[model samples]
Target chain A: MKSGTWRISGRETSSLPLFNTEVMGVAARRTRGRRFWSNLVNGPAARYLFILPTILFILIFLGYPLVQSIYISFTDASLLRPDVNHVGLKNYAQLLSDRLFWLSLRHSFQLTFTAVALQAILGLGLAVLLNQKVPGIQIFRNIALVTWVIPIAATVVLFSFAATPEYGLFNVLLKQIGLGDLQRYWFGNRDTAMWMIILMHVWRNAPFYALALLAAMQAIPQTLYEAAQVDGANAWTRFWVITFPYIRYTLGVMIVLHVIFTFNNFEFVFLSTGGGPVRATEVLPTYIFEQSWQYYRLGYAAAIGVAMMLILLTITLISVRLMERARRS
Target chain B: MTMRKIGYYSAVYILLILSFAFLLVPIIWVFLASLTEPRQITSGSLWPGLRSLTLDSYRRTLGSADVRIHLRNSFVIASMTTIATLLIATLAAYSTSRFARISGASITVVVLSQMFPYVLLMIPFYQLALQFNALDSYASIVFTHVVVALPFSFWMLKSYFDNVPRDLDEAALIDGCNYISLLYRVILPCAAPGLVVVAFFAFVSSWGEYMFASILSQSKQTATITVLLQGYISGRRIEWGLVSASTILSIAPTVILFALTQRWLVAGLMSGAVKE
Candidate 1:
């Protein structure tokens, strides 16, 4: 049978709305089941399904290589060898004293920081200036994007030639303009080579940041600007109070993305100088290449690769966290 | 708000024009240098003596020193990779957009993969290539290039697919259309512009790629245009005429493509960033 009714103190259960309560409970359970099914059958369900192939593609083709590289970092693997020996921290320990490795690491950091900072600053400036509604403005904006669109290899070669010390156009132009002292081996001198790399990086990458920021700027509702103006805010005040806060998140994302791109860049430096003039321009990636391919030190190169990955992973994590926080706040 | 306004507008215009000049200078220099004779280029003057302008540099660069082979290789590799990337990326994007519940994990994988930055993997990829006896082959470069381009293309196409209305698919299905026809007849047409954008990006990216080409392609038979240009620049002595001329030629296609798709490119990028 069923459970007994309550005593007089808590009785009157039968007098309660038992039918309604039971009906409501059953409806709630049914609604939960329908929700689960709807999520499985919705448009986003298709998106989730389609995305799986991409995930698998990246994992097998790219992820596997990354894991393999990390593993090789701890082993004595060479290009010519058929087998790898577990060397534990030997490769890492050797890297500690490797002068060239240190130099390359220094160069990578210098180049990454300099290029990213300059790019952000210039990009921000351009984005702000271009955000104004001026006539024939789209034409100027298009021209600004030219550098970013052109193939990097082409720019690298062109700049290398243009900045050439002897017969380069820049030198000739300077000499003609009476700045005869301004000309020197642009990509040849150790002191100037890294600067040239940073400059080229800035020139090529600044447009991308500008474009991203401009998009973010355009997304801000115009009503806010009108409200700011009504409150007696000047252009500068309006930007500082309204525009900056809205796009700050986009700026952070751009910075992180550019840092990754700049740190991993090898094309321009390699094309221009080949980490030359006595390895002065040798960034980490180039150093890895030299070790593995040029010197056949595959194991040591893998170690360098692992270290670069760790640094990049750390940067990426911090970037993602900042991005998430920015979104939330 | 009268004459003062005119003056301010003119000043802004002038500043923008100057910035454009800076942007165009390097490319203009290449074009001008390409037209100049070696003798004039050596003199380092912008005004190539009208009399000194010649096609000699172009002829020399395109000559049988195997420049043609490199051009062909570049075309074959870039085109093949583009096709492969579009095929794989489209399918994956379709599956993702049509079926996936949360793109959180998938998008993360794609973004992180991109974060790896091809440079870090160069050594290991090379070692693997050698192990598989795939080094120095066009297929090797193509396979590697596919990997390089797939992530970006997938991300791009997926975002594009997201813009399509779900009702389009549902309507097609209701009208007795299968998934294949729905994709081909309806969704593909809808996503045409985005597909073009993705394909062009993949093509240019593969074409301009230098590091892997330098490492993997052993001879002129497998060389791409970028590597050839690098060789000209880095030889025992610089061939300024050939280097500058070839550089101009190499950039011409991309420049023209960007110019043609200028409007679409801006719109595509803007939409992708903000919406997705």
Candidate 2:
């Protein structure tokens, strides 16, 4: 039935008359006042009409704000006073000299690399595991995605509960496993704070990569693996030679995406540690937040924001090129 | 060889189980904590016996006027943002998918827009809001949330639209249907699953959003559930019971929606990744 309808529709396009004004009565055409108006409304101009709303919206909300943010970075602006004056490179210079700014930058890089690396590796492992013809694997995959589905705020709350020092679930588990000494204040301790946030991030995001890679892995022909096995390739060799190559493009895309997301992630760090324990977890986003809202240094924060944008812009361009290459190949 | 195969299978099963446990334990722990007494949660027992479990925390949290307000605000903002985003994104996706000239520029804009960090936009948005006297208003937050959800939604929906057969458009055109009516009558209905995916993306993005919600909606009147949840964490005297219950409540909608739509969601994500 579906195929019959599809065939009919296929023929209709090839056989249908162009601009069949006969379908509309002469009276209706007279009421509508000339074919020019109808043609204009229904022609190429109509395509622009469809997209104009979105373009206008982006211009107002995204494009304008971006330009404004860059402009604000160069001026001496603060929440305290409505007036603004051009300050040249003062904000950028201040950001360069600011110890906290440098620290936050370092933290952003550390968090992005560590979290993305962990997520990629673990996600690939999970994808490989789930790709096996194991019974009930789909259930496990769905369960793994629960963290990704839940709100970051909720995840932060749960992790904070687990990380509580004295009686947290993490400590209790460690003690139960006779690794009691390994347990410490996860969020409160400076040494472990950033790592805990990274752990939380990986836990929430790895499933995304896992699911995406799993889909890609499923698309790979089974004959490739069979051929590798016939060639006497071991399990490790089979993975490295066949599986890894098949998913590398996807892996690259996910890595770039993860970098962008982790670098800009605000709520996970904000809600969990609030970039606390003496700024040990202060990433760029939270730093910008504090500088702008807490200290009312709007211009300085905008400068930092601009720096973050420029870095991400470069990564985005590279990602676009990679995606294009992947698409072609 | 059979023995080695058995060993390999067992190891894989064990690792899979362990990973599942790692992901599930925190959620299960939070669920248990939400049901336990406040003192018991602080005491941090691995489990609260069935007898110790009570609904008082959920009751108290839900009974609070502040939580109610925040919940309402979150619903309003997220729903509005989803509607606005879908409206704009659907049109844009349709235009790009059908038109040659617009496709290249539109796709690039959509992809590039994702890299603009929301933090940068927040500074200027705040200033704009202040100038327009739009702070603490639904319009301010909803507008920003729409922008936040737009880029990805547009891309995903465009991919969905691409899957739709263009032959149907020609068929409708022959029936005297114009572009607008054709999109309304033919393309959108056929792309229902894609629309669902886009709507879910927009809804969830705005639902869980915190940064813009916190910054824009400062007053309690406009605060979202996420903002209220942050208050629970940042407060000097933490109420673990209330926090757990509220956290569960805050996420329940999204979790339920996700569970119901996991298949479509995963498929959408896969196509978006591979196709792009």
Candidate 3:
């Protein structure tokens, strides 16, 4: 209490014992309102008060929206049309039959799988390299993380520096390398558009994996590696026998984190490609956003949104199970 | 052995350099391109000479009232989100840390909620906004941004509180400081660094959000800077320099915040996630 400088107000009551029955008695004699507040703040009720705001925020903000989403998905709701009729899974039925919907769903998973796989592989490689006892590696590690720091919107704009047609950076570089004919309008070509989206995803996320995995690698006991080296284990053998086991948990967690992230990712595809080049890069989130906003098909968008929820739920469960299995071993 | 070690390190150094270049080329170009004259980017001179660099594009981009409104919108939303997330998440985190009754269900809900497909939440949130006539209002956008930041902020702050030695809390209680006083006086001050990181995380997430902003705040009145940049971010033959300048401006706040808070942010985030 002597060193407590936080007593900025220094009220007389602040110095008093928190649950003073005498103060409660004085408050009880003075007014019921005073007793309530003191009990509210200073008494056991403060525990509920501490939790009240979060519960209220979650219930009103998250719970309500969720309930409204499932409800609206069953209705024929459109912003353009006034009436919202209960259509009973008509939107989902249409979605299942719709070729474009399936295509976008497939694209979503394809993009997620490809990007996650590539990022993990590339990330592990980068992590191994970065873990070496080389000078200036810290600077390189920081530079690598710069990609993760730039937000999604800015990342799109940065990639557009190379994505713009004839005058873009990649095209210009191509010309210098005598591959001017191979210069591509990346987001415009169907084959390249999806790849461009993947490229951007990898460019932005791989370093995060590297950072996490490197931290995991660094956490491993150095004596284990030293012991292996003394037993004539080579670099490859040491990494396989020692390094891989330790970093797997961090790697698994990072992969799941990014998987959910990339799956629900709307900004990257929507901003970069707008699901264009004939919808080659169209993923579930972008598809739903387009349906809701551009087409004003609210009910249909909600159905797709619900489908997205289901897929994400499954991925999360499977990842959890995998993590548990790994932990047990 | 020495020669093999040197050879191995040389390869590692080369790969590291290439990786850095791959990651940084666009970032370096954005900085350089934001300085070039608007005409140079469109005319195929993507890399302008250092002597020709100018801030003309940045000057012109900032002069627009539309951009100013969008920037203000982002600032208002992000600020509200930071303050709200800090207050709500910290309180909940403290309660959960001290009381085990709420921790089990709360942690489960919070973690599951993160995987709830943001797009799934988008339309319902949109309808909720329209239903309450909160469309284009700062309250509507700020509410949604808080939701986005809540899970992570809650986790981060909870872990920070968890790590706070219980001895401090007991000492405060013995000194007659109630839970509220103990939290405000001892726990919060100890977790102040975590609060800073969560606040910055909330600010950055809300600033960069686009889908919710586009839906809930359709009009320019409440559209965030991210939405504003979307209009100029296309591949049209427009002045790339202007777009670059606006982007740099929009991202400046987050970049500055990240630079200031990177150490605590990275360490806290790693520990927070792994604890799950």
Candidate 4:
């Protein structure tokens, strides 16, 4: 109580300049300004200020470019020309009839489905195998994950080297096994070109799925499995009843993420095949790039990009809806 | 055990072995090919004989000035991008973590970000760089990469920050700690492991990126390692030995980071994906 009274006395004495109004005017205003500034600095306003940089970054770098891209889709803006001519839906109309565009759209679906499906299946299998109480099981899982960590460029080059025409690893192995008939330019052949793209994607993404599903599998109670076995449920029955249901959400999450990734993925396809063997492996990403960068059809490429974005948006919504339904059911 | 039981165990082991080989052989082959002679590589032979193995590719690749410049550019750009991403993402994540209204708003942005492919963003970036006279500049590449890496980084960091207890944040604030100090002194140290994982993530993505670098990095001064590899492959004859050696160099940082932080990274991935 004595310290409090002393602090009050100190404040009252310090305010004696108030009686000498001329001397206190500037100092009083400065203190008022400082208090306001400190109030902002020490309040909830400061917390919201933290995201100001992020918001400004998005608005300037990402959002502005996106808005410009959408606008360019409606204009005949080519890098070859200095002026951007306003063309009303001409680019979009052209995309409707463009053969390569449709082929690419079709191939995009093909790759996304084939790769996602294969990854889900392969991942489930590997997760199940590794989930078994085998000694050194972690070694298998860890090595598999290495495929996912390496860069896309490295993976492409590694596979490309392995698939070299004459005596590459795949062909050489074929020769050693007395099946030289299978030896050919795997990527050059139209039939196998798309598969090669899918192979690289699956090789990279499947382990990710496996890891997710395995984590989910580990969270299930061991006693639940024991109870199921006591009830005469076999291994397959127990898995379908317990393991499958438990990991379904993780599987769903992975599927949604991977679908977006595979559909928009350019590096793997671009590096591995360059949409080669006469457009057999051409997808929307490479097609968009070729039209814009190679042909300088900036306006046209923007239109295609707009279209691709809508397709991705639609697919994402549908999958998310389906995932929600799966969770409910 | 019955014969059927023995068969089941044997089959499981066989499948495991085959799957592991499929996944691991390519990574192992990169190291082997890096040591093999260029001529042996040209013959489509993965095995260059035990005696033919040498450090010749490493010596040549390291000796090349071109490789050195690219390695430097790649490291600098990736490091810059990582630092920038962590700074922006951490502050945004921490602030947004404190408020429901703002985080809800930012989550929409993050999800919506998934819609814009790099190809869509490519033209504007090209033109923007040119307009700003930042073309062929490290700042341009680093800026583009930071933007690219931001959304995922923000999401991951936000999740990690959420995992940090809020009681501590309140206690610090109650003890006369300012908002910024609370984040730096309290929250960040708690989330240090997550920070390392996110750093590895940001670095790896920047190191691997190609499309923008291919266009923006037009000169020797700014080309990243991926661009260097692209140049080697686009030529008539790819020097496999050089490419392999370059690949080793490109992935070396990630290999070391992963070797040290594999456990932390795995946990981060699991928690990020499966949490909700």
Candidate 5:
């Protein structure tokens, strides 16, 4: 009976080997074709192919434009004149002596710093408030986020209405609160024009900072706070020691991003004031736009654009390095 | 101590509510202005009374043929831009996430693209459009919108893809699936939430975009709602009611979209911040 079983097992084993060899033969034949196709589709070439579309689009839209902008900054080109001539450093030289350019730069700095500073402070406070485990906090948070979600154009229009000299919301609210003496054309007054623009900017953007900082605040471990409390650390001390360290990275990134955005913010200033009231609110972007489109001074605008790019690039590099250093420690 | 804690909580809640009110008052004011009569809007009333409010502004703004054309143009351009951005960003993100050879270069390119002042590109883009006779066409507007939306979408999706487990890819491959099928069947399903967030972002960015849309499209035939809104503001006779109504209309879609996708949008933005 054992020999009969062995004979049966031997036949099974021999047939299995024969079957395996047949399968291997087929697989070997198929692998050659599969290998070629896979190499073509899934190899190094494939990576380039996958990224080719994005790269091509960027090159055409972003890279080409950037190069052309730089080139135009060195030439005398205007929309009105068809003929273009290369003029080395003339636009840059003119910009150095241009009072409007200096004034615009100063206004851009003033607006960006003030708005970003206010946003960071208010946003941090709001974030901490929302971080509490109170009921209906989500609703409050959503209401705050509404400003961020609203279109900038809509915000501009609404605020423009609010800032009108007579019968506007700002003046109305002030009068209701017994400050009617301060009622005036918010955007028409040169002194208040930049401030109104800055206020609008802060209103539109502070919610973004609040949301971002709230996320960072939520990520802080509960254990740290508990341990700090046990160690007799007061609220202020605990915040300085624990919360500040945790959110510093996010804060740094937010500040840099906000600065870049506010520096180049054309739409807000353009739509609201049009850098008006004698260019009181004119920043680098609006100035560039006015030069290019309104005045048809393409070369001069391109030079300003180049200058803006350099400033932005330097700030970005410095901020990135600072962030990397912070991450390391 | 319990009394003190309750007092503290109350103070915090009060402050939070006040901050929320400050943020919401502008939006509420705008809504009220939109509903009020044109003359009543300038009456300096804190809140317009029921007698002062009317739906006529909505009727008039929505009824206008010019407004309708502008709205349609905005929607078509934004939707086309969103679709094109998603398609290109998805493929590029997949490649960057899956392959090591091109990932670093691609990421660097995306980051660098973000730093370029978009104002600098406007002139060259306009010139190029003029050269190609692409002005007043959806093609030019949509193309620029896609360019603006692609870099961030690529980064967001790439980060999401990074979080997806690689085991699924290998398992699918062992099951005899090719790369393309693997993406559609495995990676895409896993990354569906990320894709939705990217799509929402693309749609909103294009929908609210003002710069290129205003520059590239000149005539009312091709102008976006934003351009039209600007026109209303800059016109000789400013109709406050109609302007307010159009403002609300232009913002309504985004507001509704935000309310619906608030959770995902918040999550996506938080992840982006943390990752950065």
Candidate 6:
């Protein structure tokens, strides 16, 4: 109570200066009068005018839709119906019971793991290769990012076309190479569809990761390597002790972003398989489409949407925290 | 020891060569098939048989009733989106960096919006677009694309602008230059490299976008090249020749654009993670 009373006294004392300045200080009043209206009309107002459009766009397009999806998660809504029937947790309950949902969830995890793991490993390996100042190496580096440049939808269609069992270029090449018997259906069957999609995803994304990591790697100084070499360290030792540690944080961030991108991707899978021959390759995005658009069960799809958001949120938080902590140290 | 080094070099070369071939094969196959007559694909002869080469698929895909209109629509939408996004993002990022601080909540919202699965936005955005009476209009496509592409451009340009020395602005102010003239004459020219990267990325993204274009547009007048490509390939009886032809054509402009601006792309893409 004493401290509170003292703070009130301090504020009252500070306010007395303004009143005295207003009454007795003509110079101060003139300066304040000149700046006040202009500041009000120009400075703060202009700043807000600059900021408002972007904020409004984000809110209406991104924010509103996210909330709507959450609302839909609670009710029994479908694409065919205009009105949603409130069913509370029933849709989520149904999602838990649905076998296809579980399977797609598993497939989504599988896709993310395989794609990210291979992309990271191969990307790092390739980055290391190109980091050497080999002759004509710049051309190879130029070609490396081409896969990333290709559209995902185009890549999917091309790969799907290339993997066709009968007239596929892959099958033809295999047959010519004496593996005719093993030329199986790449996207026509359940067993191989997801695997093929995973391969395509890796092929498309690995170079992108390599480029990102390569850039990170180049930022490391040559002095460290020279010092290591002077200390009689071999290539392997120098790499492990220097290069690996240097790019580790960047790699972690890239991996998390890759995970999120791969997890949310729709065009590649949708174009290649449309979640079937038998719903074998359906990840969460395609699964949501199947539920909401195909089967017209919007609420159940929204539940899946919520689950996806939670999973992605957990992954992102963990990744950012882990990498950021390491960065600070 | 010298022999071992040569062998290692050869092995590496072989691996790289094989990987390059693997990467280019599908793309080459598409090109070859585009030249092959539709009948020959079913005949199962490879290499276009050296005798099956024709421009029938290209003629068909490009000369279709709706192809030209769709291409025009795509060009208009993507071009508009690119120009508008660049303007808004450049201004917004400059203001956010220089004039005022964007709150944590705003940052969070931006990040979350970017992370949002396009699938989740499909229905709601569509509903909103229709309610606003923007359905099947170029404005709808352009606006939706601008929203999607703004964050990237803003973030890219902001990071680049932040690295710029503020002394330039202060010096301009001392010289009695206003903010507008300073930005145009000084800041923008200094940020040319970043602007190129932002513009290229925005254009490429808007060019290649499929999901929104597919959902939001139904008629040829508003449909994009990707949607048109889908139309050619949707039936059970896939028109492999025509589909391949159109796909190749669709990518041609972008491929050329990237090839020309590869230096800037590498610099920009690398800059996000690479701070040298």
Q: Interface root mean square deviation of every model, in Å?
A: 8.7, 2.9, 4.5, 6.2, 6.8, 6.0
Ten contiguous residues with the weakest lDDT in model 2 chain A: A1-10
lDDT of 3 by residue, A100-160 (tens): 8999999999999999999999999999988888878776765566677667888898887
Q: Per-residue lDDT for B142-183 in model 2, tens only?
A: 999998888888888889888889778777876777767888
C-alpha RMSD in Å of predicted model 5 compared with the true structure: 7.5
Instruction: Report the C-alpha lDDT of model 5 over B74-104, residue by residue, as the tens digit.
Output: 8999899989998999888888787644667
Candidate 3 deviation (Cα RMSD): 5.2
Worst window of 10 by summed lDDT in candidate 6 chain A: A3-12
Q: Candidate 6, what DockQ?
A: 0.33
Worst-scoring 10-residue span by lDDT in model 1 chain B: B173-182
DockQ of each: 0.30, 0.57, 0.48, 0.48, 0.51, 0.33
Residues A86-163 of candidate 2: C-alpha lDDT, one tens digit per residue: 999999999889999999999999999899999999999889888887678788777667788777888898888898
Query: How well does chain B match by TM-score in each candidate?
Result: 0.94, 0.94, 0.93, 0.94, 0.95, 0.91
Q: Name the weakest run of 10 consecutive residues (lDDT summed) in model 3 chain A.
A: A4-13
Q: Which portions of model 4 miss their true places by more than 4 Å?
A: A1-37, B1-9, B43-46
By how many angstroms RMSD does model 1 differ from the true structure? 8.9
Q: Give one digit per residue, the lDDT tens place, for model 6 in B1-276.
A: 599788878877776777667667788888888899888875544576877889988899889867778777877888898898888887777777666566455456655665777787778878888899888888888888898898767777777777777878766644544445566787888888888888877787888888888888868779998888776666778889878988897777678878888887886866643331
- For model 4, how does the per-residue alpha-carbon lDDT over A45-134 read when each residue is reduced to its tens digit? 776788888999999888897888899999999889899899999999999999999999999999999999999999999999888876
lDDT of 6 at A141: 83
Stretches of candidate 5 exceeding 4 Å from the true structure: A1-40
Clashes of 3: 0
Better of 3 and 4 by lDDT: 4
lDDT of each: 0.78, 0.84, 0.82, 0.83, 0.83, 0.78
Count the clashes in each prediction. 16, 0, 0, 0, 0, 0
lDDT of 3 at A181: 89
TM-score of chain B of 4: 0.94
Q: For residues B1-276, what per-residue lDDT tens digits would candidate 3 score against the true structure?
A: 599888988888788878888888887777788888776765566468877799898888888898899999999998999999999999899888885356779877887677676876776787788889999899999999999999889988999998888878767776667667789999999988888878988988888888788888878999988888888865455568778888889868877887788777666667776666
Model 1, runs deviating above 4 Å: A1-56, B131-133, B270-276
Q: Which lDDT tens digits does candidate 6 get at residues A1-329?
A: 23213111112223222213333334434776744543443333555566667777777777788888899899988878788789989988888898888998999999999999998998898888777665677888887877777666678778877887768887887887878887866987889898899889888878877778788789899999999899999989998999998898778877877888889988888988888878889889999887777787878887898888888888888888888888888
Candidate 1 reaches a DockQ of 0.30
